[model samples]
Structure formats: C-alpha cells, structure tokens
Target chain A: MSDSRPVFFVSDHTGITAELIGKSLLSQFPGQAFTFVSLPFIDSQEKAEIAVRRIEAERARSHLRPLVISTLAEPELRHLIAQTDSLFLDIFPCFLQALETELGCPATPALGLAHGMSDAGQYRARMDAVNYALAADDGLATERYGQADLILVGVSRSGKTPTSLYMAMQYGLRVANYPLTPEDLERTELPECLRTYRSKLRGLSLSAERLAQIRAERRPDSRYASLPNCQAELQAAERMLRAAQIPIIETTQRSVEEIAALLKQSLATA
Target chain B: MSDSRPVFFVSDHTGITAELIGKSLLSQFPGQAFTFVSLPFIDSQEKAEIAVRRIEAERARSHLRPLVISTLAEPELRHLIAQTDSLFLDIFPCFLQALETELGCPATPALGLAHGMSDAGQYRARMDAVNYALAADDGLATERYGQADLILVGVSRSGKTPTSLYMAMQYGLRVANYPLTPEDLERTELPECLRTYRSKLRGLSLSAERLAQIRAERRPDSRYASLPNCQAELQAAERMLRAAQIPIIETTQRSVEEIAALLKQSLATA
Candidate 1:
C-alpha cells in the first residue's frame, strides 16, 4: 500500500528551500515510494487555491493524503494552502513568528527574497565564484591557484568536478581541482602546484567499486574502468595524500553538498 | 537595538536544509544584522549538548535569545537541542509526526540521508549533467546541442554562465549557453544552431546600464564596456530574440537562483 504517494513542494519563489526541507523529512521514510512535484511561484490566492485543488485531486486518486511542504510568505495564500486536505507543512510561518519574538519585531514577509537579487553584490560575487571555478577546473588555470579557496585532488571520476562546482555554485567558493594522473601517482609526493597550495588542498577519495562503476559509465570495459585499475589508483592517491598530510574525504557515500560543507568548514578553521 | 542577533542552524548532517529554511525566514527580517553559525554533523547527544552550549554562550554574548533552526532526526538529539536557552524552531519533528499520522507508520530517523548519496544513480546523473554543462558552455560543443535541456542565448556578460551552471548543479539539468555576437545580432533571424533548437532556447536580457557595469569590471575603459556599446548590443540581441519568438528573462535584478528557477519552470511547461 506504500507505493507512489504524491508529494508537492510549494513556494512563492523558487521552491528550493521547500524542496530541501521536505526532502530531509521525506528521506527519513525510506521504503515508501514518493513522487515529488514542485509548484513554484505560487504567490497569489488563485495559484494557492489551484495547488490545493491539485493536491486534493491527487489524494482522491491515490487514496492517500498527499504531503504538502510549502514556504509561502503571503499570509492569506498561506492560510488557503494550509486549509487543504493534504498533510500541510508550511515551513516559514512558525519559524518567522518565533524569529519575530526573538528579534522583537515583526518580520517583513518579503516574497521572493530568499533566492532573489535583494543583494546585488552577493549575487555578482556568486557568479564570479562560478566563473572562477570553471576557469580553474581540472588544473587548467594554474595561474589563479593562489586565489583558490580549495584545491581538490583525486583520480578521474572520483568526484572532483561536481564537488568543486557545487562548492563554487552553492557557497561562492573559488575551488580548483586537479586529477591525479598515473605520472602524479608515481612521484610519491604531491605535485609542485599543490605543494604551494597545501593550506587549501583537499583530497576526494572513492571506493574502488564506486570508482570503477563511475569510470565504466564513461568508458565501458576499458582498463580505466577495470576494478583493479580503480583500486590501484585510489590506493596510491590516498597514500600520497596521507603522506603529504593532506586531508582526504571519501566521496562514495557523501553527496556533493556534504563534501562542499566539510570543505567550507576546513577552510574556515584552516 | 535590533542589531547583531545570533542565529544557529543546527542539523545532524550538513545543515544545508536547516540553513535554507532559516535563511528563507531570516530574509524576511532585513536591515538587522544577524550572526549566523552552522553546527553540522551533530549525530550524537554529546555533539548536540555541545551545540546547545554554543548557542547559550552566543545568547549570553549578544544579550538576545538566539534563534535556532534545526532538522535533527534523532529524537533525543532533537529534544536536547530544543531544550536549549535559545528560541528553538525544529523543522522536522512536528512535520514527521504529522507524516507518521498520515502514513500509518513510524518514520525512520536516518541521519544524513537528506543530501547524501543514498541513490547513486541520481547522484551520477547529476555529475553527468554538470560535465555536460561544462562541455557545452558558451557554444563550444554544438554536436551535443540536441542533448541540452536548455539553450540559453544572451550577449556577453548577461548572466548566462552562472545561471546555466546553477540549473545543471542544482536541478541536474543539462544547460548549454551561446553568446549572441554582434554579427548574429545584426541579422533579423536567430542563429542556425539556435533556430534548430528554438524550442529549447531561452533568452536572457539585462538593463544596458547594469550590463555595462558588469562588463566594465572585466575590461575597464573599453568600447565593449561602454554604456553606449552595451546598449547597442543588448538592443540588437533583444530584437533578434523577439523576431525568433524566443522567451526572454531579464537578469538585471534577478539572482542566478531566481533565473535558474524561472528557467526550470519554463522547461517544465514548455
């Protein structure tokens, strides 16, 4: 009976915050199959009511009350969505009310401000960080290595690119990544560029099985995709990283968000 | 007196979900400074107690009740954080209880599952999307034009790169961007490659003044960065896009997050 339950993430803006919060809750219920639908830009009473009707229809079809997670800021619209038959969780209002009490003032309840251009300078800075990440990706731009906030080293397909990009896109960190080639692994020491940036160096490691699986997707049945090859490269790289006293994070079980957060934490304390 | 309030985002994992929800709420209260700190990886009662102590110390330092937003999954850890000196807003417990009531089962309190690699396929898909975005960026690889989920066209420095990268990084969308050079702008029709992929084309425009300001940061005192030159390029690009009937989004006052959300919305309905 726990199959194909409908879940809706509603928001007046991007619905990303709603989705992130809802996913955290939904992930707790692992066995159930949930179909996620995002209803973004629900700023008006009309849109809110329409979302309610859709949820109702979905509930009627599935014989299960759909879970609705929303971050609606407008009071009237929020109230309308809350009255729906779905199991509603409006993320912002209760928190905002508590925040008003703690701060001793009513919140402004600004719509679309969570992920909007309220601060132009921050927006531009994030864009600049993205460009910096792209330009310095895969050790292509060593000239800007001095400006890097993080330098990730790992074998190919060990998740250096996506983690670097995520760190840049999400937290606006200037991240550069270098892939550990066979030559670099044979040296038994860190690369010269990485040595100068030791303060910023972070290593990403993955299990041999996961590395082989990922590499196989890129190049099927090749020597690079062989499990033995993956094991050798990973073991060598990890040993090199440990010998050089560089911190290593295993990326097999962790998501890119988690890796980026750990990187940020290390940077802050380093 | 509404200055420098302390805020803590506590979570059993990376704290991203807590921070997103908290930021959405705090963005409503502008013009007041808030010192935000994240306490991640608090999976144990000891770490949870340490976080409470930190929050209490911050509250004592600021003479203000700190606002704590958390998505802790463990019952005991959630309880420990909730009973802190700060005004607590735990995001998950009430919602999870409601979900359990609706689903007719108790939810599993899995730590660090929200953004973790619980589903390897989706994670790999996201990494593949990031690689695709990088490969096809700025009209570099046209052979894979058919594979793009979005084709963004804009004049130089019109906020295409970051938005494309965001769509790829956040939503796992394969976004490809092309710059509208002056030669293409002078024409009455869209470029041939774009015309083939017109259904996927999304145009981004900016206020000429803002565009000039952004361009000036890269190349000061150049004709390309001059206000008049930017005004001309933007006008021609806008005219060409309009002639081709491509949907346009103004990036002058929109963050990359906003632009990516709008882009995803358009793609969903298109």
Candidate 2:
C-alpha cells in the first residue's frame, strides 16, 4: 500500500529533541512512508494560521490527515493548529497539563537549559581555534590563531566543517579549520597562520580513496578528485604534519562524535 | 581553596551510555573543580597513547590525579591506561573480569544486536540534516528553497543558522534559510528568492531590542547593531511577509530546541 503521509514537527525553540523523539517514535511503524518537515520557532498567530493552512492543503491533496508533533508554549497558536484536520500531538500542552494537574498548581515556566556545560573560557578558546582554521581570509585569522585552544587542518571534504561546528555547538568550543590546498601540499609546510599556533594544530586525515569519492560528489572529473592526486596530497600532508610534530586523527572510518571527542581529549591534554 | 581536577569520559562504540555511567560515577566526588572530556572510539594502541598523554598532562598541571573512565574494548590499551598515574576506572574491564569468572563466555562481544538498531536511523538522519544545513550556501539554498522540507527566513541575528542546522541534524530534513537583509526591508518586499518559495518560507522574528543585543555581540558599535535600525528592519520585514501571506514565528523568549520543535510540528501537520 502506498502511503502519502506528511509528518510535521513544530517548536517554539530548537526542534532537535522533538524531531529525534518524533523520528524514533515513527520508526516503530516499520514500512510506513511519510514526508517529514520542521517549522521552527513558531510564536505568532499569523504564522500559526499559515501552518494551519499548509496542513489543510496537505490533507486535501492526500485525502489523508497528516500528523503534527509540536512543543509550542503559546496557547492561541495551539488552538489555531487544532482547527486543522491534521492529527496533532502537542508535546508541551499534554505534558504540562498533566504535570500541572498532578501538582495542583499551574505549571511553572520551565527554562530549558542546555544539558551540560563546558568551561566558557576553554570553549571560546577552542571555537577561536576552529574559526582560525576556517576563516575566509588568512591575515585576520593569523593574529588570532594563537588564541585558539584547538585548530583542525584537513584537505577539502575531510569532514572538517561539520566536525568543527559540532565541537563549537555541542561543547561551546571555538573551532577553526583550514582546507589544505594543493599549494600547501607542494610547499610541504603548514599554512602560515597555523605555524605560530603549531601546538594547537591537529590534522584530520581521511583515506585517500574515500577522500576522492567524497570530492567527486562535489566536483566531478577534477584533478583534485583524481585518485593519484588524492594519494599524493594525503601522503604529503601526513608527512608535513608528522615532521612538524602536530597530532593527526584519521577520520575516514570515524563518526563525527568520535572525532569531536578525540579533538576534545587532545585539546584538554594540550 | 584552589582545587583543580581533570574530568574524563572514556568509551568504546557506545559513547552515550559510557558518558551516562561516567557522569554518575564522577558525581561521587563533590565540591571538586573539574573539566569533563569525552574520549570516544579509542580503538587502537596509538589512539590510547594520545589519550594517556592528555590524562598525564592534566594530572601534572592540576597536581590532582586525573579521572580516567573507560570502556576501552582492547585489552592492550586498557593495560596501557592502567599504568598511567591517575585514577583509572575501566568499566568494561571491571564488568568483563567480574562476569567472566561468573559466566562461561569471556563476554568480549556482547549479543543483542536488536538494541543497536533501535534508534540508528533517527540518529543518522539527524546527523545528516545537521551537516546538510551547515553546508548549504545562500545562493544554492535560494534556488532549492521551495523544495526544502522546511525553510527558515529571518532578520540577521534572529538565530536562523543554528535553528536550521539543528533541525537538519536532528530530523534529517533539507532545511533552507535566507536572511531578510536591510535592503530587502527598505524595499518593503520579500527577496526574489523568498518570493518564489513563499509556500515553504517560515519567518523567525525576534524582538528588535533582542536582535540588536545579539548583533552587538558580533559587530559592536556598528549601524547594523543599532536598536532603531533593528526595530525598523523587523517591522518592515514583518509587514512585507504579512502582505505576501507568509508566516512568521516570533523568537523573543524561546530556546533553539523549542523553536525547532514548533517548526517540526508545523511541517508535520502541513
């Protein structure tokens, strides 16, 4: 049976947790097909009407009601959405109502703080390092490179950006990354911005074949994506990093979480 | 009392579980200043050495032995870490050693792959969405704006990037975002990109004062960071969006997660 169901996640803040929970719940119904979308930070009545209209349109198109999982705190918006034909799972209202009834008092406005904290200074320092590595221009990053707690260097498509951003967001670390261009490989020297902050620098190496495959997706039939070029770059970059005494992490087989954790450990140690 | 301590989190493949266990164990020591670091996917001898050196350095600097919590699968790395001058707590080793004496099998490779598959897709999708959102460029994003599973448009510093990335990472959705710049506001019309993708666009509107506060942090004492300018931009942008029949979400007091959740719900219902 073909199922043309749409699933929507609406939130008043970062919808990440709700999306995860919704997806996990949806997984229980194996073989079910659905199109998923997220509408983040819905706070006004006018926006609520737009969301309601979209649900109405989807219901008319598919001849089946969509499912909405929301965690919005605004009562009027929730009421507006309820008018739609969709099946609604309002996270905040359901949970808060139950909690309020049980406690015999109106639910207190709960401030959703991040689950954990890292040292603010250390986190900022790490972020600075990542920013230095990824900064568009070299001159500005150079003066500030030394302030970074950890800097990541890798060839393009080496999973540097996501890894750096993950470190910054999850750990509140300032992370900077620089893509090692062919010029840098030919010179067999670190980027000038990276030299003074050698102690903070860490190299992210990927398998040459995997690197080529990833690069091929973005820029097909390019010299940079060639197997031989990839191999040469990998070898030269590793040799340069090794000679400079900069630590290296092979990210080809590792997940983002693994790489971030490894980077964190390296930073703490350094 | 200047008490400095190094905190550590060690894990094998299941870092989340290890983090939980380690946090629980670490709670026993109260009133001690510490730094928490996760050491995930430490599968090899070389990687183990990298972790050990970090622990050793932390121990030396703080004059307090570092806390080493591990679920290292390899016996050799377990032995190597044990030799370090720190408080070593190897969860897997302790459990395996105890269980081996009691049970027949060594329990090296535990069974129940069923538990592994439970939330794998959700986790993967979330990670992919996050990566995609971060890598999306303004121009490319504009072209595919209507095809987006969700779209976020906002004034500068209204928390669009983080929210969009969070949605993608947490829900595995293609999220496209466009910033409603000052020029667009003055014209009293949505950008051409947003105009084409009106149906998919969801606005993130923050209080003008709040927007100014956020922008001030990034570019202090600039015209872009002025409260009056932010107020004007927000008003003009909202008016333009309303005239075009687009939806807007106010993000004045909401958290990122909350915003994302609301967005997900809206899309799911839509």
Candidate 3:
C-alpha cells in the first residue's frame, strides 16, 4: 500500500512535533502504509472542528479507523479533536500533565509559541547562521572564519556544505566549511588559515567510492571524478586531519541530520 | 536558570525526534531554566550505561532530579536507561506499544532508523534539492527553473532564500527563489520568467518595518534599507501577486518551519 492509511499530524503550532513523533512511530510498522496530512495553524475551535471533520470524512471513506497524533496544547481544542471516534493518539496531553506536576506549575497554553516567532532572538540567530553558512561556504580564506562556531574541512563531496547548512539551520550554529583542495592535500603542513582556528575544526571523511559517486554527479567522467583521484585526495586529507588531531566524522553512510546530530553530541560531550 | 538544568535527550538514532519533542515540552513551561543536551548514536549497551552514569552524575551535582527524554528503540537499552531513577521521560515506549496493538503486529525494533541514511533515496533527494536550491536561487530565468517543484517570488529580504533553502533541506522540495527588483515591482505585469511559472509562484509577505530591519543588517543606511523604499516595493509586489492569484505567505511573525509547513499543507489540500 501507499500513504493511504489516513494519518493526521494535528497540532496547535507548526505541527512539527506531531509529524516527527508520528513518523517515528509509523516507521516501526514498515510495510503498513499511511497517507499523512499535517494541518498546522489549527489554533482555534473552528479549525479544530474542521480537523475533526476531516478525520471523520477519512474514516467514512477508508472504512477504517484513522490514526491521529495530536500535539494540541489547549485543553479545549484537545477535547474537541479527541471527540473523533478514530484511533486518536493525543501525543502531548499526558506528558504535559506529568511535566506540569513535576515543575509545580501549569503549562501556559498559548498558540503558535512552541516553534515560531515568539523567540525573536533565537529566530534571528538561526537566520543569521543560515546567512553565515551561505557566505562562508567553500574556500573562504577570510577574517569571517573567526566568527564561526565551528569549521568543517573535507575533500569535495565529503559532505561539508549540507552538514554546515543543517547545523546552522537546526541548531543556530555558525558553521563554515572549507573544501580541502588538491594543493592543500599535497602540502606536508596543515593549511595556514585552518591552523589558526584548529580548535574549531571538524573533519568530514567519506569513502573514496562514495565520494566519486557524488563527484560524478557534478563533473562526470572527468579526472576529478575518477576513483583514483578520489582515493588519493581522501587519504591525504584524512592523514593531514589525523596528524593535526582533528576529530573526523565518517559520512559515507550517514544522512545530513545524522551527521549534524553526531557532531553536535560530540561538541556537547567535549 | 540558563542552559544548566541538565536535560538529556538520549536516542538510539539521530535524537532529533527526542530533541524536538523534548524542546516542545520544555517550551510549554516558560521561565523554567534548563540546559539540554542531545546524546544521539546511543545504539549500544555501553552507550546506554554511559548515559545512565551521566544522568546520575548530573543528579549528584545538581541535587535535583535531571530530566531525561529518551527515544531509545531497543528494549534492553530502554530498561538499562530506566535504572537511572531520574525524572525520566521515555518518549516512545508507551506510544510504540499502543501503535503495535492498534496495527495488530509487533513492531520490528531497530536502532538508528527514524531519521538517518536508512532510506538512501530520501537522503539523496534532500541533497539534490539543496543543490537545486543553490543552483536556482535569485533571478534564475534559466531553463533550470523548469525542474523546480516550487518557485518563491518576493522582494529582497522578504524571506525567499531562507524559505527556499529550508524547504529544500527539510522537506526535500526543489525550491527556487526569484528576487523581485525595483524594475519588476514597477511593471504592471509579472516578470517574464515568473509569468510562465505563475502556478508555482509563492509570495512571501512581510511588514515594511521588518523588511527594513532585516535589510539594514546587510546594507545599512542605504535606500534599499529605508522604510519608504521597503513600503513601496512591498505594496507593489503584493498587488502584482494578487493580480496573478498567487498565495502570499506573511512571514513577518512566522518561523521558517511554520512557513514551510503551511505551504506544504496548502499544496496538499490544493
């Protein structure tokens, strides 16, 4: 089957939490198919009623109990959505109650605050970090490197740009990535600019075969995309980073989110 | 009172679901101080034991129960972390059991599958989308716009680039953004390239004050950053978009996540 099990990620804010948790749960029952819909900005009774109707209509059409994972924060709206006879999974009500009991205060049930412009400072920082990632990508031998929270170094297609952008976008990290050139790999010593910011450096390492596959997408059949060239560059880059005591992340089989999370955890533990 | 409350988001995979849910729950309780850490890649018994020890150490130092929100998939690791005796929030266990009973099948438990390279096709699509966003940014009247899934059109600093990149990175959408210059805003008709792709156009709308503030960060004291210029350009652009029946997203008070989700919902419903 396809995405046709009629899954709804209902929430008061952006519905991101509902989507994340719902998807995680569904991934476990891999072969079971479900069509997911995220109805964000459902911050009102009217919208909640609409969501209930949508779910009801799905139940009528599919002749099956639809699945709903709701992160609705308001008690009233939560009850309204729960009125649906579908297999309702109220994602956050019990947890919020537990948290409130622990914190010794009731949660403030405000709308659109969980992941929106309510925190202007954090929002601006993330935007600024995205701008920094765009500006500081590739060979930037400039003073702007000083402002970076971290610098990623790797040979081409070793997963620098996407990782830098992901860290910046998700974690508000000012990440700059410098691609290790063939000349930089040839040199016995580490690049001069990178040496100055050695403490902020993290190396991204990937297998030569994977690197060639990626490079082939851009410059196919060229010597730069050759397996031998990729092997040599990766070997030299790894040796240089190891010699300088820079921690390296093997990104051959990891997604951007995985790379960013592992790297963030390393920074936190370090 | 800052990031010092010793909150741990432990997971067997990327920890993103744990982080997103944990942060959402924490955000509900305002003014409660906490420093959160995401310890991803916790797939082994050794890592689970280390996490327990870390939580125990935090409990010893803070003299308060540390908050732990774990998404560990393995039942054994989950049991191991449960021994910590802190204010543990095992985020997924209860939900997973409920889902299993609902689906009439036992979940095939595994580590590091929620958000990683386990689905290589989706991962490659996201990377390709990011590359597409980079290649198709700005007034790209090029033939490459034909390949775009969606095209965002707005005045400078009205939030086209960030939205494009965010959509590309998060939702794996090939988003291409086109900046409307003074000349395009002055014209009665939409720009030639944009007119052809009117069906895919999304307008990002924001107040003049916010636009001026954002532009000031890039080009301070310039006419482009002046309030009047911002006001005039936004007015003309909004009118032009309305004439063409393009949906405008007011991004002045919305995060990138919210905007992307809302846009996605519109697409799904449409």
Candidate 4:
C-alpha cells in the first residue's frame, strides 16, 4: 500500500519556492501517500508548539511519518517537533550549513543577497515589482507609493487586490491599487492622489453584470451591488480613466492567469 | 547600456508560476531588458485594446523589441497585441499542445482540477480528492485537505485570498480557506463548516500587533482598529482555534514564499 499520508510546510516568508521544490522532489516518489501544510511565520515558541502538536496528531491518525520544510526553525520549534515520531526536514538549516561549509562564514543570519542572481532572486524581484504596482499614494501599503512599479485603479470587487498580489508574488513587481469611489466618478477625474503617479497607473474594469455579481455576494441588497448602479459606476470610471490616458483591462470573464499574462505583456512592451 | 528595466507580473490567480517560468526562461538571456506585467484577467476586448495601446507607447519609448508572455491568446487579444512591435509568446497554447502530445489524449473541459492536471484520469482523481476535502464534515481538514496539496485561511487582513491564489498558480494546489471571523471567536469553535475537515484545516494567524498596524492603516481610529481590540480579537481567535484543536500559524513578518513553503509542508504531511 502507498504511504498515503500528508506532509507539512512551515515557513517564515513566501512558502511558494519551498512548496514547488518540495513537490518537485516528492513527484519522484509515486504511490506514496503525502500531506502538505504551510505555516507562514512561527516567530514564537507557543505557535511552534501548536504546529508540532498538530503534526503529531496527524501522524498518529495517518500512521505515517510527517516531513516538515521550513526556513525559521528556531531551537524551540525543533524541540517541539522532535517529540513527534516523524521525519523532519528543516530546509534552511541544511542549506545554511552547506553554504557555511563552502564560504567559511557562520550561518547565524541568512544573507539573502549573498546568493547570486538566481531564479529565486528573480522571483523576489518580481514580487517587489507587483507590490510596487499595487501601492497607491494614500499611504496604504508597506512601501512608499511613489516607488511603485505599477498602479492599479478600479471599483471595489473588480479584482484589484488579487491581481495586485498576484503581480507581487509572481514577478516581484511593487504594485498598488486605489479604489475609484463614487466621488471620484462624479468628479470625472482620477483621484488627486493618483496624479503624481499617473504615468505608472493602469486601470482594471469589470463588466457591470460581473461587478454586480461580485458585490452582491458581499452586500446583497445595497445599491452598490445592483447591476444598474454598477453599470453607471463602471461607465464613469472608464471615462475618467480614458480622459487621464490610463490603460484599462476589463476583468469580467477572463481567468486570473489570462489577466496577469495580459498585464505582463502590456507592461513588458511599455 | 545595461537593460535594467523592472519586470512586472499581474495575475487573477497566483502569479508565482508565471513569474517563475518567465524568470527561468529569461535567465537564458543575460543582461536583456525585460519587464513582466501580470494582469489577472481581461474580460473585455476594449480593455485588451487599451492594454495593447499602452504596450505600443512603451515600446516606442524603449526603442527595443519587447517580449510578451501570456496564457490567453484568443484571436482578438492576439490581434490587439500584434499591433505592438514586439515578440509575443502565448504560453497556454504551447503548453496545451505539448501536453496533448505527451499524454496522447485529447483535452476536454473539466471543472475543479488544476490546469496542469489536464489529463482526464489524473484530473478526475484530483477532483475527487478536492471535493472530498471540501465536503468533509469534521473540523479537521482531513487527509483529503492534506491531499489538497494547497490550503489557505486567515482573518480579513491577513492576506489569505491573495496567498491562496499565489499558491494555486505556482504549485497547482486545489486551495481552499475558511475565514476565522469574530463570530467564530465568540463561540470559540471552529466553524461547524470546517469540523469534519479538521485534519486539513491549517490556521493562519497574524500577530496582534501586526493586525492592529494593518487595520490602523485602513480604519485609523475605529475601535476595530484599536490596539486593544486587535489584541483581544487575535487572542480570542487563536484560543478558539487552539481549543478546537486546529493547526495554527502566524502570518506576520514573512514574505509570500515563506508562507507557501509552510503550507506545502503541511499538505505533504496531511
């Protein structure tokens, strides 16, 4: 019988690279049962204990050993997981040790920049680019909006947040977004805050029908969720964006993949 | 002069895979000018045309041939992009053709499977696993959730929606998440909605301090954004999750990659 149990992934940063690397590694073992979990950041011993206990319980139920992949495995975390009778793989420690042996430097604090330009580095860059793109001038994001690689503007539920994040994680672009409010539509002008960064601005527009569907889920009976209201808002927003010469992409029916690709293509050529 | 322009990535789903694949491909050409733009989905031809026009304008300024990579290459989109004097690579068609040749079977429409698992047999198995995980009655997310290969959950601002999408595009996991709301905290119970799925339910918790910081940025002086309220909500939520015996992870102080890794580990062991 296949080992059909699951594995867990805990990390202190983007768990994606590790997940991909882990999955690629596991694909080599077919018919083996596995489970996967991703813990974002375990900076505290208490949280680590909670994670360890959960892993142990899963192991007991599945009757299989669990594998853990992580970058922030403090001693306390290790101790907690060690109590569980499961195989643990701490990726960063092993990587650090290997790098230390090669470079004669202690691996106390992992030096991210020391690693040469790698695929991972490129990924980070892409993430930065998307983060830059999503940032708006309203002091809403982690980084400064002026430094954004691109800016997205749209009405609520037009898929701005997800799109902006996708840009960040996938391509390392710094992205920011501003929701076009009713006031902005009525004024028929871009938000005053967006003017300084107008050159980098891009717009996301969704069909009124689609926007209504999305908003209805969040606010079932509000005028904001009605199709006619959505249509009016969308029309006004589009006109304002066009007057500002901001490029727009409609997200009514396309998949997220398609939208990201289209934006990337447009931005690349731009 | 070195081509040092930033790369952009936008996506409706997780943009990680495209960023990774794009970066991998770009690495083959050193010191090349490149930018990645990921737009999650473009539902309207008019919006696509606007994107194309922006690309043209950018290309005119850069004075170099641009490279465009996209998953969607419908004829209209292709025509719009063709107007730009740049090289375009439509990834999905090529990917689909390659898969068709590899699997020696015709692809057909199927719902709820990863794009990579286009093969009918594998797709069916994956769909079954996902549906089973979703339909699980226990709060434990179960091996099915572990089998999910991807899962996401969090409070409103902990960034679960974006992160789940990033995982799906990058790792092709059938991801799902259930929010930990104030009601859930008050009851100190995992959503009866998630009970049967306990084993598969990984928790996403952000630091109370971080949650306050994030909330403050959005709703500066509201009680919900107050430090005390943030702390209380976080404590209550964490306690509820713990009492319910669910696995929990904090999402503060980590990048997207780290989160993806932790989830991958959990899924592997699940």
Residue B2's lDDT within candidate 4 is 56
Off by over 4 Å in 4: A1-143, B1-165, B168-262
**Highest DockQ scorer:** 1
What is the DockQ of the complex in model 3?
Answer: 0.77
Candidate 2 Cα outliers beyond 4 Å, as residue runs:
A1-112, A115-140, B1-10, B14-135, B138-141
Worst 10 residues of 2 chain A by lDDT: A110-119
Docking level for model 3 = medium
Writing each residue's lDDT as its tens digit, candidate 3 over A140-227 gives 6447999998999999878898898999999999999999999899996789888998888999998889889889999999999999
Model 3, runs deviating above 4 Å: A1-4, B1-4
Inter-residue clash pairs, candidate 1: none
Q: Alpha carbon lDDT of residue A24, candidate 2? A: 37
Deviation of model 3 at B37, angstroms: 2.2
lDDT of 4 by residue, B1-270 (tens): 654433333222334443543443454344345665554444357766766766677676664555554434355665666566655544344333433343345443222122333234553344343333334322244344544544455565675644554555455466676566667677766766567666766778888887887778778989878888878877887787788776777667555545655676677666
lDDT of 1 by residue, B137-224 (tens): 8888978999999999999989888888788878889999999988888887998887788899999999999999989999999999
Output the better candidate (1/2) by TM-score. Answer: 1
Residue B13: error of model 3 in Å?
Answer: 1.8
Candidate 1 chain B lowest-lDDT run of ten: B119-128
Q: Taking the tens digit of each residue's C-alpha lDDT, what string does model 4 give over A1-270?
A: 555656676643344434543453344344344667765555577877787888878878875566665545355665676566665555444333433343334544322211123445564476445435434422376236667777778887787765666666555667787888888789976777788888778889988887897788779999989999999999999999999999999766555544665677677668
Candidate 1 wrong stretches, greater than 4 Å: A1-3, A56-62, B1-3
What DockQ does every candidate get? 0.79, 0.09, 0.77, 0.08
Candidate 4's displacement at residue A247, Å, is 1.6
